[model samples]
Target: MPDAENTLLLVDDRPDNLFVLRMVLAEYLPDCRLITANSAEEGLTLAGRQRFDGALIDMQMSRMDGIEMCRRLKQEAGTAIIPVILMTAHHAPADLRARGLEAGADDFIERPIDNVELVARIRTMLRIKHAEDRLRAGNSELERQVAKQTAMFREYWKAVENSRDPFAIIDRGHRYSLVNDAWLKLYAIERTEVLGRPVAEVHGDEYFDAQIRLSLDSCLTGESVQYEQSFSRNGERPQQLQARLMPIAGEGGGIDGVVITLRDVTREREIERMKDEFISIAAHELNTPLAVIQGYAELLRDEPWTAPYKRTQRQEFLSLILEKCARLQKIVDDLLDLSRVDSGWMLVLHKSRWRVRDELDRQVWQFQRETLKHRFEVACDLSCGEVSADRGKIGQVIENLLGNAVKYSPRGGLIRVQAEVEGNVLRVTVADQGIGMTPEQAGRAFEKFYRADTLDTAIGGLGLGLAISRSIIEAHGGWIWLESEVGKGTRAHFTLPLMPAGTEVAIPNEMSDLKIAGEEKP
Candidate 1:
C-alpha cells in the first residue's frame, strides 16, 4: 500500500512569511498538506495531538524564536523524530548556520528563501522521514513474526520430548539439533554432550556393534533406514532395540537432515524364540505317534496270514493302530492351532450375545463324558448378561484352562470354574486342586513353550495352549493372571469389561506384531 498522505508542520510568527510559505507549498506541492502553526505554542499543541510527516519553521520570531522552537521540538520524545528545517535570513557568516544546526535544525536556508530551493529542501526532509518510518515498520513486523515462529517451534519440540519413543533430529551440517529425553535415557547420554555437535563425533563408540553412524550418513542421502540392535548391560539379558532413520526435507525440497527414532523390541524377540521352540517340540512330539501307527501297519501288512496274527488278535492290533493314528491327527491339529494363533490367522466369530453359563455347561458336560477321574464344576451366574467378545476365542480360553486343570490333577481332583459380574466387569476364575507350581514356574507358565520342569517332564504337551489362551483373552480388552503354590492348587482369574453386547474393542499391538513375527519365523 502506498504510504499515508504526506503531512508537514509549518511554524512562523510573521503572518506575511507564513502566507508566502503556504502559497508556495500549495502551488508547487498540491498533494502535500501544509499545517501552519502561527506560534510555537500552536505548533507544540498541534504536534502533541497528531503525527506529522515533517516540520518547517522560520529562524526569527517573537515570544519564541525559531531556534528555540526547534530545540523544544527536539526535547520531547514524541516530537523528537519530526525532521526540523530552519529558515535563516541572516546567513552572511557561517556561524549562523552552524548555530542553527546546533539548536537541532536539520538544515538551514537563507532568505529570501528561493521558491524552488525552499520546495526542494522541504521534499528532502520529507523523503528522509518516509524512509525512517518504513524501516521502523519493517523491523516491527519482523519481530512479531519471529516471536510467533519461536512459540510454534517450542510446542513442536515439547511434544517430541514427551514421546515414549527415542527420537533425535540433526541439522543439514549433521550436527544434533534436537534430542528427546527418551533418546537420552535409552543411550545413557547427557544433553550437554550431544547438542550442536556432529552426530558421528558425539556417537562414535556408543553403538560400537551396530552401523549406526553409517545409518545416519545414509539418511543425509534421503534414505530411510531401519534395523535392530541389542544392548546388554552387566549380566542382564540384552534389550533388543529397533532403530529407524529417515531424511528430513528443507523448504526447497532438499534433504537437509535426519530424524532418528528407536523402540524396544525385546519382548518381540522372546516371542520369536518361543515360536522356534514350538516348531522343534512339535516335530518331536508328532514323531512318537506316527512311529507307532507306521510300525503296526507294517506288521499287519507283512503278517496277515501268520498263526500268531489270528483274526481277533489282528483286529485288536488294527484298533490300537487306529487309536495311535487318531492321536497323531490330534497332535497335528493342535500344532496347527498354535500356528494360527501366532500368525493371527484364526478368525473368531463374535456372534450373538451368548451366556457364559451356557458355554461353561457345554465344556462341563464334555469333561464329564470324557473322564471319570477329575470332577469339573461350574459356579458362575446362570443368567449373566451378554458380553461383547469373540465367542470362539472365549470358549477356546475356557477349554484350555479347564484342560490344564485336568492334566495337572493326575491323581483325580476337583476343578472349579467361575464367572460373575463385578461392577462394570465380568470376572472369571478357574481353580484346580492339582500339583501346582513354584513361584518362578508360575510366573513363566503363560509364556509360549514354557512349563514347570518337574510336573511337565513326563506330560505330553508343547506348552503353547496357555500362551494362546492368554493372547485371546487380552485381545478382548481383558486381563488374565494366575497364583500357584508348590504342592497346593493353582487358580487363574480373568476379567473382561462389561458393556453392551456389540462394543468395539481394539486389539493390542502385541497381537499384531505377534502375527508378523510368527509368519517370519523359521
Candidate 2:
C-alpha cells in the first residue's frame, strides 16, 4: 500500500484487459484511485479534464497506439509531466520497444504480466512524479520571496532618496556603499564619483581624520555617535550641521557598517542666540525706567514742606517720575504689540480721514522739543490729502522712525520730512543725516529682535520698533522700507493707499491681505 493518496489513469481497447488491470492495481495499492478509459481518445479527454499522478497504457490499440498517445501527452503543457508506462505484448519486437521509448514513455511492461512486477512499476512512477511536484512548488515559493524582498528594497531606497536631509551608508571598509540624492546634492558630486570610493578620499583626508573617522569607528563598534560640524561651500556662509551615525548590523549579528544622516541647524542656532540676547536687553530696558521712577518718587516723598523752593523741587520730581512712567508704558506697549503679531492677531485699525501732513507735523514738532542738536526740514505738496487709516498706529510708526533717526545720529545733522500724493497712494519719507547702517543691516532691520547697534553701543530700546511699525503699516494695506549706507545717512519711506470718499472700511482679522515689501538699500 502506498503511504500517500495517488490517482492513476489506465487506457486499453479491450474491456477485459482494463478490468484485469484495475483489479490488480486495487488489490496491490488500495490507497490509489484508478480511472479507466476504453480508448486512447477517451484517455486523452480524461487527461485534459483533471490531473493524474501517473498513466498505464496498452501498446496496441484500434485507432491510436500507446506510442502515439504518449507523444501527444508529452507535447501538451498540462500533461507533459505525468509519467507514462507503456504495456506491450510478450516477445514484442526490439524496434517496437525502441519506438515506444522514443515517443516519451517512462517505462515498459510485458503482456504476460507478473502482477507484482506490474504493481512495482506503477509505484515507482508515482513516487518520482510526487517528488517533482514538491520541487516545483519549492521553486515557485522561492521566486515569490525574492520578488517581495526586491520590492521592499526599492521602496526603502526611494524614501531615502526623497529625504531633504543628507543620508549615506558606508561599508565595513570605510567605503561609500550608498548615498541618497540629498547627500550627492550637498557635495555637488555625481553618484558614479561617490559609490565604492573611500570616505577619506571623497571628504578630504583632514576632515575625515579630524571629525568623521573617530565617530565612524565608534559607530562600527556597535555604538551610535552624534556630533556637530560646520561646513562652508563655494565661499558661502558656513552651515552648522548635526550628524548622527548609527550602526548597521550584519547577518551574523555583528556591526557591519554605519548609516550617516546630516541635518542643517544654522537658522535654529541663530534663533537661540537672538532669543538669549532679547532676554538680556529686555531686562535692562525695563529696569532702567523703574530705577528712575523709584528715585524720583522717593525724593518727592521725603521733601519737607517748610523748605524754601520745596514747591518747585516737588514739581520737578513729579515731572521726572511722570516721564519715566511714560517710558515704561512705551516699552510695555511695544512688547504687547510683538506678542499680538506673533500670535497671528490682527492690529485693529480705527479708520478715519486724517491728513498725512498733519500727522507728520505733529511727530516732528514733538521730536524737535526733545532734541535741539538736529534741525528739521519739512516739505509737503498741496495735493497731499487725507487718508483713511488708524491715526494712533500711523503716529506710532512716525515716532519710531523719528526716534531711530535721532538715536542713531549722535552727531546731529539735518533731518528732512517730505509728503506727497502719488496717484492713489500717499507717500511719506523721513531722511536723516545720522550714522546709518550697512546694506546687510538695513535688509534685516525690520526683523523682530534684530538691531544694527551692538550692546556696547549707547543706543537704547528693544529692536521691536521697526518690526511693529512694519506690521502696522502692512495692516493698513501699505508698504514700508529703508534705504541707507554706512556712515552716510538713512532714508525711511512708506506708502498708504487713499480710501475713496463715502467708502466703508473693512478691517481684516488675520492681516492675510497685507502686501508687505522687503527693505531696500541705496
Candidate 3:
C-alpha cells in the first residue's frame, strides 16, 4: 500500500542523471519499481501503459524540458494524478522555479546532485506519494463496490417494474423512488411521469398528501396499513382501489422506505352491496310478520270489550293470526329456496316436465283467488306446448313473478300474463301497470333482495322474489329479464327452449272457450 511498492517513472535525457537517481531510489526506497525513459515522450508513453505512483523528471532535458512534459502529463487524465519532481543542474532561477511550480511539479531538487540533498528531497517526496497511493487504493475499492451495488439495484428495479401488480416505493421525503408498469397502466400514465416526482405532483396534492402522511407515519413506526381509496382520472367516475403499504427496513431497524401495492376493488365492492341488500331485505321480511303476530297477541290480552262479544273478537284475532302465520311461512320458504340454490341441493335430486299451458292456467287461477284486488288476465294460445324443466322449479319461478306483480301493483290494474311459441323458444311474459323503476333500478332488480322503493310500503314479503325467479329460469336453461320505465309499467319476460333438443313434448291443457284477447301468438 505504500508508494515505494508502486511503479515510479524516471525520466532524464542524460543516462548519467537517470543512473544516479535510480541508485539513490534503489538505496532509500528498495521496494519501488523504476521505469526508466530517456526522454519526456518515452516517459509519457510509460505513464500511460503502467500505473505510476510518482514521476522524476530532469528539468534541463534537450528535446522536451521537464516543465513541458509535466504539463502534458497533467493534461492527459491517465497520468494527471501522478506526483512530478523536477531536477535541474543549474541552480534554477527563482522565476524558473516559479515556472516549474506553475507547470504542475510537486517538488524541485537542484542537481549535480549533492547526495545528501538528493536523498533527503527524494525521501520527502516518496513519503507524500506513499500517503496519496494508499488513499487512492482505498478510494478505488470503494468506487468498485458502489458500482456493483448500483447494478444490483437496477436489476431488482427492472423486475419489480415488470410485475403484474401495481407496485411503487417512496422515500421518507415523500418522493417516488420507483414505480412499476402496472401502476402506470392503471393510472393511464407513463412510468417516467411519476418517478422522482413528489407524491403531490402525481396524485393531486390534497389526496396524495393525506394518504402519504398516514402511510409514512405508520411505516416510520414499523407498522403496515391497508385501506381503500377512490380516484378520478379525467372526467370519468371515480375508481375504487385497495391499497397496502409496508415498511422496508435497513440495518439497525431504521426506516428505509415504503413499498405500496394497489388493487382495483370496484367489482368486489359492488358484490358486497348486493350481499348487504339481501341481508336487509331478509331481516325486514322476517320482522314484518313477527310484528303483526305480536300486535294481535297484545291486543287480545290488553284490550277490553263486553263479554257477550268475546266470541266474535276471538274469531277475528284468530283470522289475523293465521294470515300473519301464512306470511311468516312464505318467508321461511323463500329462505329455504335460497339455501337450496346456494348449496346445489335442489338441482341434483330430481327433474320433471309439465304441461306449460296447464301450469300457466293453474298459477293464474290460484293468484286470481288469492289476490282478488288485482285484475289477472291470462292469454295462453299455445294449448299443447310442453316445457322440459324441473316441475317444482318452473312452478316456483312462475309463482314468484306472478306474486310480485300482484303484490306490487295497484288494486284492479291490468296484470297481463301471456305464453306463446316463437321458433324453437317458448316465451312467457307477465306485464303489470304498477310502480315501475328507473333504468338503474331495473338493472339491479334481479340482484338478491333489492328494492328501489321505500321499505314503508309494508309489502309483507322478502325481496328474494326476482332473485329466485331468475335463478330458476336460468337453471332451466332459459333466459329471463324485465323491460320497464318509471311510472309507466314493468314487464317480466322469460324464454325457454321449445323441447330441449331431443325430448318429447307433453300436451299443454284441455281448456277451451279460450277467449285469449289482447295477446299475440309469437
Candidate 4:
C-alpha cells in the first residue's frame, strides 16, 4: 500500500490483460486509484481529460502503439511531467525498447511480468513525481514571503526618513549605508556627501575614535549602547545629544549593521541642572532661618530668671525669634505661590481701585528706613491716577524689586523709583546701580528657579521672587520685564492699566483681601 493516495492509468487491448493489471496494482498499491482502458487510443483520451501520477500502457496496440502514446503525452505541456511506463513481451526486439526510451518513457516492464518487479517500478516513479511537486510548492511559498518582507522594509524606511530625530544605518565596514533627512540636516551635509562614505571621514577621525568607535564596535557585537555627546554646530552653543546604537540582524542571524539614532537633550539637561541647584539653595535658605529661631528660643528657655537685665534680654531674644519666623513664613509662601503657578492655578488677585503714586511712595519710604547701604528716591507724576489691581500683590512686587536692588547694589548706590501715566496705563520703573546680569541671564530671569547669580555668590534668596512677580503682574493684565548689563545696572519695569476717572467697580470684601505682614490697608 502506498503512503499517499495517487491515481494510476493502465491500458491494454485485451480485456483479460486490463483485468490482470488492475488486480495486481489494487493488491500491491491499495491506497492508489486504478483506471483501465482497453486500447492505446482510449488511454490517450483518458489522459487528456484527467490527471494521473503514473501511467502503464501495453506496447502491442492495433492503431496507436504504446511508444506513440507516451510521445504524445510528453509533447503536451500539461502532461509532460507525468511519469509513464511501457509493458512489452518477454521476447520483444531491442529496437522496441530503444524506441520507448527515446519517447520519454520512465521505465519498461516485461511480460509475462513478475508482480513484484511491476510494483517496485511503479513505486519508484510515484516517489519522483511527489518530490517534484513538493519542490514547486516550496518555491511559490518562498516567493510570497520575500514579497511581504520587502513591503514591510519599505514602510519602516519611510517612517525613519520622516522622523524628527536623526537616524542612520552603518554597515559592518563602518561606512554609511543609509541616512535620513534629519541626520543630514543635523550634520549640515548633503546626501551625496554621506552615503557610502566612511563614518570616520564624516565625523572627524579624532571624534570618531574618541567617542563613536567604541560604541559602534559594541553594537556590532550585538550589544545596544547609549551615551551622551556634546558638540557645537555653525559656531552656536554646544548641543547635548543622546545617541543610541542598536544592532541590525542579517538573514544569517548575526549582527550585520548598527542603527544609530540621536536626540537633542540640551534643554532637558539644562532644566535638570537648574532643578538640582534650586533644591540645594532652597534647603540652605530654609535651614538658616530655622536655625536662628531654634537657637534664640533655646537661649531664652535656659536663661536664669533672676539675672540682671533679664527683661530687656528676653525682649530682644523674642524679637529675633519673631523676625526669623517671619522670614521662614515668607519662604514657604513664595514656594507655595510658585507651585500654584506651575500647576496652572495662578494666584487669586483681589482687585481694587488704588492710587499708583501712593503705593509707590509708601513702598519707597519703607525701603529707605530698612536699608542704610542704598539711598532711595521717588519721582511720581501728578497725572498718575488710580488703577484697578490687587494692592497687596502689587506691594509684594514692589518690595521684591526693591529688595533685589538693595542686595545687588552692595556699595551704597542710588535706587530710584519712578512712575508716570502713559495713555491708559501707569508705568513704573525701579532702577539700581547694581552688579547687573548679562543679556542671556536677563532673558531667563523670569523662569522659575532661574537666578543670574552663581552658586558662589554671597547674595541669598529663593529665585522664585521674579517668577512669582511675573505671574502676579500678568494675572492683573499687566506686563513686567527687566533690562540689565553686566556690572553696570538693572532696571525692572511693570505697567498696570489705569482705571477711568468716572468708572466705578466692585471691590472684593476685606476678608478676601491678600494680607501682607506690616503692609497697611487702604
- Name the candidate that leads on TM-score: 2
* lDDT (Cα, 0-100) at 203 in candidate 2: 85
Better of 1 and 4 by TM-score: 4
- The alpha-carbon deviation from the true structure for residue 74 of candidate 3, after best TM-score superposition, in angstroms, is 37
Candidate 3 lDDT, 1-522, residue by residue in tens: 554466788999989878888898788778878889999999888888988877889888888999999999888888888889898767689988998899999998876677788666666776787787778899999899999999998898888778777898998777888888888887798877888888888888787777667777788678998998887778987878898999889789798889999888876887787677667777877787788889988887777656433778878987988998998887888788676766655443135566787888888898888776788888876453676766776777888888778776865588998988877778889999887777767777776556676456656555777777666666555677777777777888887776553432322122111111223322
Ranking by TM-score: 2, 4, 1, 3
| Model with the higher lDDT, candidate 3 or 4 | 4
Q: What is the C-alpha lDDT of each candidate?
A: 0.78, 0.86, 0.77, 0.85
lDDT of 1 by residue, 1-522 (tens): 122388889899888988998998899888887799989889889998898888888877789888888888889999988998887775537776777788788987788889999888878888888888889899889899989899988898888889888998887777888899998887688999999988668767665325666777788888899998887666776888898888999878889888988888888887787677667677878888788888888888788454567788788888988888877876766667666666656445464577888888898888778788988878878546677777877887888888888888888889899888887788888899988887667777876676565243556777877777767776676677777877788888777776666554544435432211113311
lDDT by residue for model 2 over 323-362, one digit each (tens)?
9899989999999988888887655577788887888889
lDDT of 4 at 313: 82
Clashes of 2: 0
* Residues 360-449 of candidate 4: C-alpha lDDT, one tens digit per residue: 889988888888888888998888767788889889999999989998898878999999877778888999999988877787888776
Candidate 1 Cα lDDT to native: 0.78
Name model 3 segments beyond 4 Å from true: 1-166, 180-182, 185-188, 232-240, 250-255, 265-281, 294-316, 370-373, 454-460, 500-522
**Which residue ranges in model 4 land beyond 4 Å of their true spot?**
1-164, 233-236, 498-522
Root-mean-square deviation of every model: 8.1, 4.8, 11.4, 10.1
TM-score of each: 0.62, 0.79, 0.58, 0.65
**What's the CA RMSD of model 3 in angstroms?**
11.4
